[model samples]
Target: MPEVPRTADPFTAADLVLLNGTVRTMDRAGTTRTALAARGGRVLAVDDDAAVRGLIGPRTRVLDLQGRCAVPGFIETHNHPTFFGLTLAADVDAGSPPNATIADIVARVEQAAADAEPGTWVRGYRYDDTLLADDRHPTRADLDPVSRDRPVCLQHVSGHFCVLNTAGLRLLGIDRNTPDPVGGAIHRDAAGEPDGVLAETAAFAAHAAMPKPETADLAEAIGLAGDAYLAAGVTTVHDTGLGLVGGPAELDAYRLARRKGRLRNRVRAYLVQDLFPGLSGGELSPVEAGVAGLGDDLFRVAGVKLWADGSLQGLTGCVSEGYACAPDKNGLLIFPQDDLSRRVATLHEAGWQVAIHGNGDGAIQAILEAYAKLGLDPLEGDRRHRIEHCQMVSERQLDQMAAAGILASFFIKHVYYWGDRHRDRFLGPERARRIDPLASAVKHGVTFGLHSDTPVVPVPPLEGIWCAVRRTTRDGHELGPEQAVDVDTALRGYTSQAAHLGFEEREKGSLEPGKLADIAVLSADPGAVAPDAVRALQVDATVIGGEVVWGGAGLDAAPAAGPAAGGGDGR
Candidate 1:
């Protein structure tokens, strides 16, 4: 086992002590103890109840876990906090369970338009054309009925495509004469006119053109998102697309959120490459401008985010073979191979950890090729370059990633939400069955982490862990039992492995002396529960830096109140 740190004064009193519980110190040896102590926002010790009791002083806050289970708090590796927050605060929810058809979505938009002032853009999100009764993306004709005078845009659940009304097309100055961007498409009708569906860069351009939410509203949204994460026992989040909304000003919104006491979780932010001039045509990239590791622990600019391809479910991910449903149609790459390689090499050499989104096997291969062009041994350093959503990686790719030391952050929830479609329509049985392939990655000696990819999905780490372990689809069909991992491995994907992906292994990810006292108290030990019942285990309390941030009402320690509970530079 790695050496655990101890305080200089063994008699120093602890700020908090949790006793009579299954303390799973997710350490190198997987130590288990009945009690744990914390002081100065760091773990003091983990031992039997009697051994920890000595650290409890007169002012120590004690909580009796009553035999419940306590493990390290979850660390979400890839998510879009700014975009997710804005969606919750401003956008219309056009997801299924509420709107089953295209007409239903049209009606929802009509209602939203009626409620809003005239001429303002009406946006809807999380609409899945594949799941809709119409089985097609909404066109300008369908959305025009809502309001031809208003510009309306409906985002696909995949976030790779969107349907814009005629008014929106005109607002963005896109038409039949407009040529498709190098890495994106403006889907056209039989008449050679843009059909209002934009893919990849096209959709991204439209989103960038749309008006940004007010800074105050953005801060509140951040707070709301943080509250949700805290309730789910997530102590840290990797905002994979920083400056995604409102460009560089989005960083200011984050600072505002932190100042208002709304930003609670530790955020390791990745600058969206497209939004930065340095990554584009400018001379000084953000890294050169000293933006890397800019903030304190609460919010730090960690790396740069790039996209290799699009979403698989949306038929935009670059697959090695044609889609099972559309044999003639292979997805597109977001960047040319040479362009991607050059960009990656430039960023890697500039000291930026690059996390490229690659959902399909072809895209994964492209990313690997890009890494290879760097001509540096990945294993030689702690670069920790990552491939996000490596959903369709094969054994060969896993071996390459293992040899190259690239981390795979799998969006494991896809098995539960889209596994059936992937098997039946997207990739066919063989490929779909290997989607996420946690067991194969493990066998090939590749390190991996699990993510929800919120607001693509909710930030429930347990659901991701369950999906990884069970490999079951929404309808309870086992999509790939062979790829299923054990509970401990699944847990580590969300905890230890996730922390490592963000380069934060020493400060977080486990319960150990000298580590931050970030923990989640669960109703039951997930490892002890039946595999099928693990998802049912609730988070009873969440502690961040030795402070109870959510739940814990029954304990003597009151949960932190409002924005004051957030950590870091009193910005």
Candidate 2:
């Protein structure tokens, strides 16, 4: 024969192939390619020419990217997917909607009452009293006009506070006599009467008191949130806590979603520390339980989440120095230093990852001190513990965290959402500039991830990257120029670094042979574009395990569910 040509073998060809795109591997080698081939939900090969062609056979689905930009799927290290879905289904937007004030909130509630069945609860969310005309939290009297017959619940955007009408209060059995729950207090009036404002665990209790949707409905809503994550170009998320979604039933909710084929993205969950309390009421609770290592690859409870302090924007963060607006208040600590350290040590010694919400320098320092006492050095053991919202920390604290081998995830969105307020009042300009110091963290050689902390902000990685890179406030002023990071570092915060946070680096977060094929296709190369236009870049496709999950030109797909039973990578 004069010539012979080889073709892809039918038996071993790839199931899917993507070609002609800029692929950022995000691996140790920092490989870049224009094509990829996948089989059995894992990457088979990454190449550009004959290598990719040989993987495509008669049964393969070959996608031509036509020169777009593709990177590891955006991984949200911290967020609230199920709760985001639940809020989308049940809560009204009291802030952004036509209702921006308590009066407007009343009007929206009245409208909800018009068609709602009697005795059903009506809920609204994102009600910012600071922005309201009255500049005060809504009280029961304000909600009574809407419907005294039906209970009304309004959640502050921070997810840390809630306002309820009188009926709602009665439903929760609160009449000022209900002393504050441990670690949670009810905001009462000067006369010692409940003012309809519930803080911390009290807020959680009141919100949990609402009638829950059926299991199937809740699962569906959770699925919808997964879909939302995919559409937003996020293929993995860390559901930071589960107290609001059915308590221990939260385990059931996520399990059911995965079993029903509703879960379309990877989830590593953390249960509330309350659910796994080492001690209760300053003493151990009679009933003992666990959530660590629960579920499989699709859903795994990897850690316990404890709140050391409240939100910085809410003026409840435990700061080393007092707030400028309220110099008398230094913010609330959810757990006393001793109790928090004990709980953290218990979990750390048990080999479970502990994720503590630490927003202020005080909280960060306390958490690091607790880690230091553990004595199980990272050089000797697996202590990839996390600090959520490590937004306010000193340089000394960063060095301590680095030495302790602690990982951090920052709520960088705050720079944009509440920067001016933080600068002008919360921390004042000097302390404000250090909030979420991306550049400083990078300089200190500490690994960290960026987050939205959803319900507080949307799950938009591009925006987060923008926030980290620009540090721009709402009014176009750069919050902290020195804190801003470059484009590549910002991208890593969402990709390779995020994988490290979830301990999934070996499997996802990179396009490499033998790894699950998870990739995000962008309309334009994020690095090649002007810095300010990064957020403006649109998602073209999101793939998980070689299958299209979102933005694939009308492709509706689910994530790759590996083995039914697999251990959590608290690696």
Q: Give the candidate number with the greatest lDDT.
A: 1
Model 1 ranges off by over 4 Å: 1-11, 278-283, 286-289, 557-571
TM-score quality measure for candidate 1 = 0.94
Per-candidate local distance difference test: 0.85, 0.79
Worst 10 residues of 1 by lDDT: 562-571
Q: Which regions in candidate 2 have their CA more than 4 angstroms from the true location?
A: 1-6, 208-210, 277-291, 554-571
> lDDT of candidate 2?
0.79
lDDT of 2 by residue, 458-566 (tens): 8889999999999999878888799999878888899998888877788787888998887788887788889899999888788787777666662211222331211
lDDT of 2 at 102: 79
Clashes of each: 1, 1
Sliding window of 10 residues with minimal summed lDDT for model 2: 562-571
TM values, all candidates: 0.94, 0.92
Q: Model 1 scores what on Cα lDDT?
A: 0.85
